[model samples]
Target: MPKDTDFLYVSARIKYLETKLLGKNDIERILDAPGPDEALKLLNDTEYGYDIAEMENIYEFEQVLDKSMLRTIRTLKESFENHELITFFTLKNDFHNLKVIIKSMILGKDNGYLSRLAEISPEEIKKYAEGERAANIPDSLKAAYHKAMGAYELTKDPQRIDFALDQALFDEMGKIASTSRDPFLREYLTALSDLTNIKTMLRLKKIDGDIRTLDNALVNGGSLPKEFFKEMFLESSQSLIEALESTPYHQIIDEGITQWESTGSPSVFEKLIDNFMISLARRGLYKPFGSETVIGYLAARENEIKLLRIIMVGKINGISSDMIRERLRDVYV
Candidate 1:
C-alpha cells in the first residue's frame, strides 16, 4: 500500500490529465462529423490525436485506442509506488486476453484482439493456452486455463471459455481488493460483482435458465447473497425490484427494470450500471490524494475510451445521432 505522500506528485499529474478527457461538446462534435474519417480526425484536437491521426480503418482505430490505454497504464505504473493498485486495472485486460486466447485455440484460428494494457504479455498467455506451462503464470490463472481447456475438450463449447475466465477474473479482483485493504476499492468490486450477478439473472430469466446455471455464474464477495439472486430467478420483474430495494443500487435497478419493461432492451440496465460506476468514481475527486484518485482516473479514462468507441462505430455505421446519444454513457468531466 502507498502512503498519502506517495501520491502527491502522481495525483497532480492525474489532475492535469483529467482535464484532457473528452467533454460533452467534444463528443457531440465527433458524433456530428460527416464520416468515420472526419469523425476520427476530430480526435486530433484531443489527447488521442497524435497517436491515431494516421489510422486508416476501424481496425487501426481500435489498435490506436489499445495503444493509448496501454500508454496510460504504463505512465501510471511508473509514477506510482503501489503496483498492486495499478494491477487491479491491468488484470482485466489480462483476463480478456486469456479469454481470447482460449477461444482462438478452440476455434483453430489465430485471430484475436489482444490488448497491450494487460499486466501479462499476450505472447505469454498464448504460450500457456498452447499447452506450454510456465512457472511464472499466476496460480489462479493457470488453474482457470486448465479448467477451461478441459471443459472445451469435453463439451466443445466456446462459451465455457468466457464463463471460466469471467469467474476467475472476479475471483482475482476480489483478492486484489482485499489485499489492498482499500475500502473504496472493496466496495466498488462488491457492487460490480452484485451488478454482474443481477444482470446475469435477468438475462437468464428471459431464456428460462435453471437455478443451477444461474448459481454457477454468480461471483462470490458481492453484498447480495447467492440465495438472494437464486430466489429472484424466474420471478417477475417486480419481484426483482422488491428484492433489490434494500441495496444501494435500488434506484438504478428499479429504473432499469421499468425501462427494460417498456423498451425491451438490455442496454438500459447496462447504461445505468455505467452511470453508477461513474458516480462512484466521481466521488474520488473530493480527495486531495490517495489510491482512490488514481482509481477514479483510470475508471474515467476507460469510460472515455468506451464512449469514443460507441460514437465512432455509430458514425461509421450511419446510425442516427439521437440513437447514438441514447446509448452514450455519462461524461466524466
Candidate 2:
C-alpha cells in the first residue's frame, strides 16, 4: 500500500486545478450567450481555452471537449503510479467507444467520431468487433464484445448490445475497486449499481417489458441483490421507494421517481445521479492527500464538461437559459 505523503505534490496540483473549475456564474454567462459562436467565444477564456482555440470550426465543438478529456487522461497517466487503479474512473469511455463501434457495424453509420480517451484504442475495438484478435484488449472488453455480438446474432436485437456492454462496465468498475482495495470506489460502485438497477426496474415497469428484460438490464455488483429487484417488481412505486427507506439512496430514488412521474423522462434522475456522484467525490477534497484528491478533481472536471456540453448544445439550438438550466448538472465549485 502507498502512503498518503506519496501523493502530496500531485494532490496539491489537483487541488489547485479544482479551484479553477467553473462556478454557477461562469456557467450562467455561457448559458446567456447569444448563440453558439458567442458560447464558443466564452470558453476561449476558460481552462478549455487552448483546446477551444484549436477548433477550426465553431460547430466542431466536440473536438474541444474530446481534446480536453484526452488531456485530463494524459495528466492522470503521467502523474500517477497506480495507473490501473486510476484508469477505473476512465474505463467507461473505453466501453462507450466499443458501443459506438459495434453500433456503427450494426447500423452502418460513420464510426469516425469515437472518443480517444479509451484504454482499448478504437482500432483495437474495431478489430475485435470484426472478429479478429487485438493486442492489449482487456478481458472485460473481450467478454462484452463477444456477448454483445452473440446476442445481436442470436436475437437480432440491438438493445441487448447496450445492456450487455453496460453490465460489463459496472462489473469491471467493481472489480477494479475490489482489486485496488479502495473503499470509496467500492461504495461509489455499489451506489451506482444499485441506482442503475432501480432505473432499469422502473423503465421495464413503464414499458411493461418482461421480467427477462429486466433481468438482463439489471447490472451485477450492486449492494442490492437481483432477488430484491425480482421482488421489487411486484410492489407499487411508493412501496418500492418505501422499501429503500433504510438505504443511503432513498432520497435520490424518492426525488428521481417523482421526476419520472412528473416528466416521464429519465434525464432528471440521471442529473441527480451525476450530482450524487460528484457529492461522493467531494469527500475526496477534504482528505488532503492520496488518490482521493485525484478522484475528486476528476469527478469535478467531468461534471464541468457535462455542464459545458449541455449549455453549448442549448446555445447552438437557441434554447432559453431557463431550459438550459434545467438540463444542467450541479457544479462542484
lDDT of model 2, residue 123: 87
The superposed Cα distance between candidate 2 and the true structure at residue 327, in angstroms, equals 1.1
Clashes of 2: 0
**lDDT tens per residue, model 1, 1-68:** 55777888789888888888888899889888877788878888878887786676665777778778
User: What TM-score should be assigned to candidate 2?
Assistant: 0.95
lDDT of residue 323 for candidate 2: 90
lDDT of 2 at 191: 79
What is the C-alpha local distance difference test score of candidate 2? Answer: 0.83
